[model samples]
Target chain A: MILIEGKDITLGYEGQGIISGLSFSVEDGDYLCIVGENGSGKSTFVKTVLGLVEPLKGTISYRGGLKKNEIGYLPQQSGIQRDFPSSVLEVVLSGCLNRRKRLFGYTADEKKKALLELERLGMNRERNASFQELSGGQQQRVLLARALMATEKLIFLDEPVTGLDPKTSSELYEIVDELNRGGITIMMVTHDIHPALNDARTILHLSQGRYFFGSKEEYFRSDLGRMFMKEAGHDHH
Target chain B: MIITEILSYPFLVRALLVGILVSVSASLLGVSLVLRRFSMIGDGLSHVGFGALGVAAFLSLPPMAVTVPVVIAAAVVLLHLSSRRKGGGDSAIALISSSALAIGVIAVSAAGVNTDLNAFLFGSILSVSRSDAVVSLLISAVTLFSYSVFYHQIYATTFDPAFATATGIKTERYTALLSLLTALVIVVGMRILGSLLISSLIIFPSAVAMKLGKSYLSVSLIAAAESLIAFVLGFVSSYVFSLPTGASIVLVHLIIFALSVCLRHSIIVFRSHREMI
Candidate 1:
C-alpha cells in the first residue's frame, strides 16, 4: 500500500542543505498535504520526490504499481503560461501525453476522454475558449482535468491555490475533496494549510531541519501545528 | 508578368525557392519560440551564424560545413543557459549576440573577403549558389519532418515543461531539438535572406498570426501562410524597385504586422460587440 517512501532525504538546491534528514512515506489512497513556511523546503521536497531534483542524500522509491508517468501532476503556474495560445480542450488533452505511446497525434478516444474530463470538471462550456483568458479557478479546473488524464491512481499538486479568492479556492478544494474520497491518493504541497485540513488525512510538515509526517489529529496536538494554526488565524485579520 | 520576371532572373528564382523554404520553417518554429518568450533566440542564433560564417571565410572552408555545426553547438549552449535560469536568456542572448557580432566584425575584416562579407551581412538572395539552395532544402525538409514526428512532444514541452517532464516526456531533448533546427534554419536563412532580414522572418509573421489565431496550430498555420506572402511580395517588390532583397521583405512584413495589429483589435472589439447583443 506504500506508494512513495523517502528515507532520510536531504532536500536543497545545489549542495547547500535547506532541510535535511527528512523521511516520509505516503500510503495508497491517502490524502497527504505538505505544509511549511516559505523557505521550508516544501516545494523542494515535492521536487525531490518527483525526481525533478535529486535528494542530496536519500532514495525515493515508487511502489504499488504507481509509475512516475501514472501520477497526475498539477504544478504551480510559472506565469509564462499566460502568454501561451492554447484552447481549453487542447490543454486538457495534453494530459493524455504520458499515456500516449505513439509519436504522432492524440487518438479519437483520447479526445473523447479529454472532453469527458472537461465535462466532469464542469468546464465543458469552456472547451473551445482560450486557456489564457480563463479565470484562475477555471484554469485550475482545466489543469486538474489534464492531470486526471495521466492517471486516476495518484495525483501530485504543488501549491495549487497560491493565488485565488477564498471562495474560489474552497470550491476548488471541494473538487479535490471529491477526488480524494473517490480513492485517488492525493499529495499536495500547500501554503494554505487551513483548507487542506478539511480533506488531507496525513500532514507532511517540512521545516528548517526536520519534517513531521503524521495524522491530522496528531498534527493538531503538536507544537508546530499550533503555531501554524495561530499564524493562519493572524492572516484572516 | 511576375512569373516571367522570376524566370528571366536566375537569382530571383533561386531567392524565391530558398526564401519560401526558409520562411515556412522559420515561421513554424517562431510560434513556439514567441510563446515561450524566446523571441530573441532567433536573433541570437543568427548572430552566432554570422560569426560562424566569418570563421568559415577565415578558414576557407565551405560555409555550411563550419556554420552548421558551430551554430548548432551555440543553439544547444543557448538552450542550456536559458533552461538554467528558468525563464532567463534575454540577458544571455544580448550578451552572446553582441559578443558574436563583434567577433564576426573583426574576423570578417581580418579575412579580407570584402565581397563575401557584404553578401553575408545583407544577404545574397540574388547570389544563392546551387549548393546553398540544396542545403536549404535539406535543412527545411529535416525541420519539417521533425516537427511532424515530434508534434505532440513539442506541444507538450512548449505549453508546460514541468507537466511534460512529470508525464515522462524528455522535454530537454525536444526543446534542444527545436533550438537545433532553429539554428539550422537561421544559418541557412542568414545565407539567403541575409542576417538582417532573418530575425524578422522568425519574429514578425508569428506576431501577426498570433493576433489572428487562438490556438497554437492555427497561429502556426497563419504564420507560415503570412510568411510565404511576405517573402513573395518582398521578393517581387525588391526586383521591381531595385531595392535590397532583405530590406524589401522586412518592410513587407512590417506592413502586414501593422495591419494585423489594427485588424486584430477590430476583431476583438467586433466579437465582444456580438457577445453584448
Candidate 2:
C-alpha cells in the first residue's frame, strides 16, 4: 500500500527553488532514509512530505487509510527549544493535540496513552521533570515519545540523532529500527552518511539538482549511491 | 483597619478587582510570551496603546475604544515580522515602539493638558470609573476564558511551533490569537500598572517563576500568584506611602525577581551538594 506519494513535487521557500520535479512514494511499513549534504533539500523535502512546508508545487497524497494524527513527526531540534519551559509529560501530551477536541484538556485515555508512550521510550521516570533540564539524549527520547503519541502507523524523523553522543545516537537508532520492525513506516532524514543509517531498507539520496530514491541494494548499485558509499567507507555497524 | 479603610472606598475596591483580574491574565500570557522570546512585544503593544490613547484624547474620543484595535493590529504586525525573521524582529519592535511613544508624547502635548495624560503615561488606577472597571472586568474575563480554552494549543505552539504545525494545529492562528490576547491584557492592565510599567507584569513574573517552578503548569500558577501578590502589595503600599501605584507594583516585582534569583541559586547549590553525597 502506498502510504505517501508525491508527484512532480517542487519544494522551496520564498521563490528560491530548493528541489524541483522530485517524485517519491513510500510503501506500508517501509524504512526510508533521506541522506544528503547541506543545501541538498533533504529537510525541506521531508517537511513538505509531512505537510509542514507548502511545496512550491506538488500533490502529496496520503493513502492506505492514514489519518492525520496517525503520522508522527520528530522535527530537528531548534535553538528556541533549549530554554523552553515545559514538563516532559506536557511535551508528550501535546502530541495528542490533534487527537484532542475538548477545549479543557487531554482526555483520560489520551493521557494514559501519553504516559505509555513515555514509558515505551524509557522516559516515564522523567515525565514530571522539566523538559529544559533534560540532557540532549533524554530530550530526544522525550520527543520521540511525543511523536509516538502522535502516530501508530508512520513516523517522520528529521535528524533524530544529530548533536548527540555516539552511544546515545546508536541507542536511538536501535529504537527507531525496532519501531520500523513493528510495522510503522519510518521516514528518517539525515545530512551525514553514517553506517547505522545504512539500515534503511530504502535510501533517498538527495543532492543539488538531482535525487535518487530506490531500494537500498539498488541505491548502492547506482553511481550516486556508490560514490557516497565510497566517500563514507563501508564498515561494521 | 487601614486595609478596611482602604477597601472601604468603592473606587479603590474597583481598582483592586480590576487589578487582580488583569494581573492573572497578564501573567498567564506572560509565561508563553517570555518563553517564545516575544516578551518585548508586550512593551511594544503598550507603546502602541499609549499612542492610540493620545490619538483618542486629541480627538476627544474614548481611549479604550481607540487603543484596543490599534494595539492588536500592532501585535499582528510584530508577530508577522518575528515569524519571517532574520533577526529584525527586535528592531522592528523597537522602531515601532519608539515611534509610537514619540507620537503619543507629541499628541498629548498638542492636545492641551488633559488630566488623562499623566494616567496614560504612568497610570492612575485611582481614577478608574465604574464603567471603566466594568469594561476592564469583561475584557479580563474574556482574556482568561480564551487562555484556558486554548491552553494546550497555546502550550504546543510556544513549545514547538513546527511540531504543532505538523500536527494540524493552526499554529499561526494561535500565535496571532496569543498576540491578540496580550494586546487586550495590556490595554486592560495599563490602567493598573500604567503603559510604561505594564510590561513588567508580562515579563517579570514569568521570568522569576520559570526558574523556581518545576513544570509548565506550576510556572503558570506561580507567575499568576506572583503578579497578583505584587499588585495587591503594591496597591496597599501605594495607599500608605503615597507612592505611584504603577511604580509600587513594579518595585515589588523587582524585589520578588531578585529574591527568587538568590533563592534559586541556593536551591541549585543544595541539590547539587546532596547529589554528591
Candidate 3:
C-alpha cells in the first residue's frame, strides 16, 4: 500500500522555496534513502513530509488519512539534545505522548510498550541511565527506540548516522533494516552512500532543488551516480 | 532559638508561606528553562517586571495587577521576536533583559515616587503581607495545576517541536503558556526574592539538580527542596545578622551552586583516576 505520496511538492522556510517540483512516494515496507551534499534540501524534504513545514505548492496525501500520531520521526543528532535531563526510559516513553487519552498521565499498557521497545533495541540495561551518559551510537539506538514507541508503519530518519564509528553505523543500519523487514516503511537521509545503497531499495538524489528518484541500481549506473561515487571516494565501499 | 522567634511573628509566617509557594512554581519552570538554555529569561522577565512595578507605582495601581499583565506581554513579545530569527532565543532574552532594566531604572528615577529603592532591588521578607501571600499561593496553584494537566504536551513541545507538531501537539500555544507562567512566577516572586535575586531562585536550584543528574521528577523535588532550604536559612540569617534579605538568599543559592560544581568536578576526577588505575 502507498503510505505517503508527495506530488509536485515545493518546500522551504517562510515561502522562500529551497526545493520545488519534487515528487515521491513510499510503499509499505519500502526503504528509501535520500543522499546529497549539505544544503541539498534533504532535511527540508524530511521536515516538509513530516508536516513541520508547509508545502509551498503541492499536497502530501497519506493512505486512509492516518492520524498525526501514527508517523514516527528521528531527527539528526544535536549535541545539546543529548544532554537533556531525561532518562532513557522517560525519553522513550515520551514518544507515546500523543497516544495517551488523558492530558497528563500514561496508561499501564503505554508504559509496558515503552519498556518493550527499549528491550527490543537491546537498551534495557541503559533504560534508567541519563540520556547524556550514552555513547553516540547508543543515543541513536535510544532515539530509534523512542520512534518505535509510536506506530511502526512509517518512520522518517534524517541523517541517522552522521557521527558514529563504522561498526556502530553498520550496526545501526542493521537495526534499521530489521525494522524495515518488520513492515515499517523507512525514509532515511544519509551522507554515507555505500551502506545505504546496499540496504535501500529506492534512492532519491537531491541537488539544488532538483530530485531524481528511482531504483538504487538505476541511480548507481547513472552519470550523476558515477560523479557522486568518484567525489565521495569509492574506497569506503 | 531563632526558629522560635521567626515562628512567633505573623509577618515571618506570611513570608515563609510565600517563599514555599513561589519556590514550587519557580523550581518547576526552572527545569524547563535550564533544558531550553534560556535560564536567563527568568532574570530578563524579572527586570521587565521591575519596569511594570515602576509603571504601577507611577499610576498608583496595585503593583501585582499591573506587573503581571505587563510581564506576560513582554514574555509574549520575547517569544514572538525570538521565533522570527534563527537561534534567537538567547539573544532575544539578552536584548529584552537589558532594555527592560534600563527602562525600569529610568522610569523609577523620573517618577520620583518616594519609594524605597532598596526594598524593590533587595527584598524585605518583613514586608510580605497576608494579601501578597494569598496571591502567591493562588498563582503557584494555577501554575502547578496547568503544568500537571498539560505535562505531556509541554514535554513533547520542549523536547522536540518538530516531532510534537508532527504528532498534532500545538507547539506555539504551549510555548505561550510557558511564557505566561514564567511571567506570573516572576511577578509573584519579585516581592519575596526581589527583582535582582528572583532569577537566582529560579535558576540555581535547577542547575544544581541537573548537575546531580536526577530524573525530571526528582529534579523538581530536589530543586524545590534546595530553594526552601535556601529561603529558610536566608530568612534566619538575615534576622540574626541584620543583613539584606534578598542578597542573603541569593548568596546562599550561589554557595549551593558552587558546592555542586565542586562536587561534580571531584566525582569526575575520581572516576578518571579509577579508570586509569
Candidate 4:
C-alpha cells in the first residue's frame, strides 16, 4: 500500500518558489530519507507533506487509512524551544492534546499510554524532571516518546540528530531503524546522509538546480548521486 | 475590633470581593502571556484602558462597558499586527501605549477633571460601587470558564506552537482567545487596581510561581493563590494604614517576588547539600 503520494508538488513561501515540480511516493513500512544542502527546500517539503505548509500547486494523498494525527512528527528543536518550562510527562502528555475533547483532563487510558511511552523510551525515572535539564539524547528520546503518544503508524523526523555527538547520533539512528523495522513508515529529513542512506529504501535529494528521487540503489548509480558522492568523498558502496 | 468594624461595611466587602476576582483572573491570563513573551502587552492594554476611561468619563458613559470593548479591540489589533510582522510587536505596543497615555492625560486636562482622573489612574478601591462589583464578577466568571475549557490546548500552544500546528491544532484561535481574555482582565482590573499598576497583578504572581513550581498546572494554581493572598494583604494593609490601594497591592507583589527568588536559591542550595551528604 502506498502510504503517501506527492504529485508534482510545488512549495514555497510568499510567492517565491523553493522547489517546484517535485513528486514522490512512500510505500507502507518504507523508510525514505530526504537529503539536500542548505536552502534546498527539504524542510519546506516536510512541512508541505505534514500539512503545515500548503503546496503551491499539487496534491498529496495518503493511503492505508492514515490520518494526520496517526503520523507522528519530531521537528528540529532550537535552543530556545528546548528550554521551554515543562516536565517530561507534561511535554509527552501534551501530544494527546489534539485527541482531547471538551474541558476534561487526559483520560486514564491516555495517561497510561503516555506513561507506557515513557517507560518504553527508558525515561520513566525522568517523568517529573524538567525537559530543559535533560541531556541532548535524553531530550530527543523524550520528544520521540511524545510523538509516539500522538501516533504509532508513522513518524516524521526533521534533523533528529543535528546537534548530538557521534555516539548519540548513531544511537538515535539505530532506534529509528528499529521503529522502521517494526512496520512504522518513516520520512526523515537530514544532512547526515551516509548512515541515513544506509537504512533508507528511497532517497529524495533536492539540489539548487535539480532534484533526485528514486530507490537507494538507483540514487547511488545515477549521475547526480555519483557527483554528490564524489564531491563529499562518500563511499558509494 | 478595627478589623471587624472594617469588614462590617458593605463597601469594603464589595471592594474585597472585586479585588479577589480581579486578581485571580489577571493571574490566570498572566501565566500564558508571560510565557509567550507578551507580558508587557498587559501594560499596553491598561494604558489603552485609561484612555478609554477618560473618553467615557468625559461623555458621562459607563467606564467599564466602554473600556472593556475598546481594550479588547486593541488586543485584537496588537495580536494581529504582531503575528503578521516579525519584530513588530514591541514597537507597536510601545507606540500604542505611549499614545494612549498621552491621550488620557490630555483628555483629563481638557475635561478639567485632573483631580478625579487620579482615582482612575491609581485606583480608589473604596469607591467600588455595587454595579462595578457586578461587572467585575461577570468578567471573572468568563475568564475562569474560558481558561478551564481551553486549558490543555493553551498548554500545548504555549509550549511549542509549531508542533501544535503540525499536529492539526488550531493555534491561532486559542491565541486569539487568550489575548481577548487578557484584555478583559486588564480592563476589569484597571477599575480597581488602576491603569498604572494593574499589570503587576498579572506579572508578579506568575513570575513568582514559575520560580517556585516546575509544572504548568502547579505553577498556574500557585500563581492564583499568590494573587489572592497578595490582594488580601494589600487591601487590608491599605485600609488600615490609609495608603494608596494600587501602590500597596503592587508593593506586596514586589515583596512576594523578592521572597520567591530567595526561596528558589535556598532550595537549590539545600538540594546540593543533600546530594553531598
The clash count for each model shown is: 1, 0, 0, 0
In terms of lDDT, the poorest run of 10 residues in model 4 chain B is B106-115
What digit string (tens of lDDT, one per residue) describes model 2 on residues A1-237?
Answer: 999888998878787887788889999999998988888888788678767777888788889988654679898986336877788999999998987778797899998998998888888899899999999999998988888888898999888887899998888888888888888889888766663245688888888878898998888778888778777876323
TM-score of each: 0.95, 0.96, 0.93, 0.96
Top candidate (lDDT): 2
Show model 2 residue runs off by greater than 4 Å.
A14-17, A195-197, A235-237
| Model 1: CAPRI class | medium
Regarding DockQ, does 2 or 4 come out ahead? Answer: 2
Q: Rank the candidates by lDDT, best first.
A: 2, 4, 1, 3
Evaluate every candidate with DockQ and list the scores.
0.66, 0.69, 0.55, 0.65
Clashes of 4: 0
- TM-score-superior candidate, 3 or 4: 4
Q: How is the predicted docking of candidate 3 categorized under the CAPRI scheme?
A: medium
| Per-chain TM-score (chain B), model 3 | 0.92
lDDT of 3 by residue, B14-53 (tens): 8888887787788888888778666777888898898788
Query: Worst lDDT window (10 residues) for model 1 chain B?
Result: B113-122
lDDT of 4: 0.86
TM-score of chain A of 3: 0.93
Residue B260 lDDT in candidate 3? 87
> What lDDT is reached at residue B4 by model 1?
96
What would the TM-score be for candidate 3 when compared with the true structure? Answer: 0.93
User: Judged by DockQ cut-offs, is candidate 4 incorrect, acceptable, medium or high?
Assistant: medium
Residue-level lDDT tens digits of model 4 in A1-237: 998899998878877888788899999988999988989888788888888878998899888888765678888876226546688999999887777864668888989999999997889999999887899999999989988888887889989998899999989888888888988888898888665457999899998857999999999898877877777778556
**Chain A TM-scores, candidates in order:** 0.94, 0.92, 0.93, 0.94
Ranking by TM-score: 2, 4, 1, 3
